[model samples]
Target: MAFKPQSDSDGALSEINVTPLVDVMLVLVIILLVTAPLLTQSVHVTLPKTASTSANIDAQPLQLGIDALGVITLNKQPVINLLALEATLKAEFTKNKDVGVHLYADQAVVYKKVAEVMATVQQAGIAKMAFVTVEE
Candidate 1:
């Protein structure tokens, strides 16, 4: 490298000195190339394989709805009371151990009624339950 002094009469230097920039970019590129292969390297192992079976994908969840008036319905059909609901749920549970219920309660329904319904469901030996809500 050579040094030059600027005279008062000389115009300002507008050209950029990109030699250092080019040097830095080349160094970065070389580092990336060296690390790229290392990043892709992984340990290989022999994996064991077992017999595959299909799940019961056809099983559908039961839809239990409670209207604003606190009337309970199972699968769109009206139920006389919580006892009937529990009987129905017990039967369904017997049919499918993995049975689930999607509970849809009206917003205006009383919390006590909902709690009663949940208790009935729990007593029926059903473990999986989901609350159905409308998206805003």
Candidate 2:
């Protein structure tokens, strides 16, 4: 009887077959391409910085205050209504592009009231806004 070469068995292969892995990776890339744009269509972009000048920049923002009675005021005078606030903001911001809005709300003011004012400010198209809060 002679030894059969076909029957001789030895596990000697040390290489990984990665064709299936490559195929799965390619599928993932295609999926990303299809969905990425759809996911970000509604996004708004913030501007990037450019080197120019910081000398004229103010250290603080123009403060818009809401007292305990839910009254709106700018700097100290009562704005009386959203229209008044918008008018004042528009006038102040007409010459300055870097003007910022800071909002202070009395703790008694509800989230709805604050959000309404924020919406009005946003509609007025102010570039930046900050919520003023007290430290404990």
Candidate 3:
């Protein structure tokens, strides 16, 4: 016998199956319906009211400057020597426990002078100190 071609009725299906798609959509709708109510549920709370008050701004930082010549100044006033600086710092620390120092050192000042000043500040029992520098 001679070879023969297949008939059109034996061709692959071209229509889409919608049963699984409808089932998945129904499941997702049911999940959303269930979760939507849960999402809206929240605990009712009663909070207490407090009196309004102004913020306290009492303390100011001390500005300490050291020039290239190794001369030290506190708050624009020159200090005699390291001993005097330590004494003054101790007094300031005693005056305000939260007092902080903003140190401004000259760009040409030596490292030794800066280190010595830092040591003196630490010896005076000051825990808060910051170096002030200009942005390049």
Relative to the true structure, candidate 3 reaches a TM of: 0.64
Residue 112, candidate 3: Cα error in Å is 0.3
Pick out the ten consecutive residues of candidate 2 with the lowest summed lDDT: 4-13
Worst 10 residues of 1 by lDDT: 3-12
How would you encode candidate 1's per-residue C-alpha lDDT over 12-125 as one tens digit per residue?
779999999999999999999999999998999999998998989988999999999999999999999998999999999999999999999999999999999999999999
lDDT of 3: 0.94
Better of 1 and 3 by lDDT: 1
Give the winner by lDDT: 1
Model 3 ranges with Cα > 4 A deviation: 1-56
lDDT of 2 by residue, 32-83 (tens): 9999999988768998999887687564568999988899998878887888
Clashes of each: 0, 0, 0
In model 2, the runs with Cα more than 4 Å from the true position are 1-54, 58-60
Per-residue C-alpha lDDT of model 3 across residues 9-112, encoded as one tens digit per residue:
77776899999999999999999999999999999999889998885476888899999999999999999999999999999999888889999999999999
**Deviation in angstroms for 131 in model 3?**
0.7
The models' CA-based lDDT, in order, is 0.95, 0.85, 0.94
Candidate 3 clash total? 0
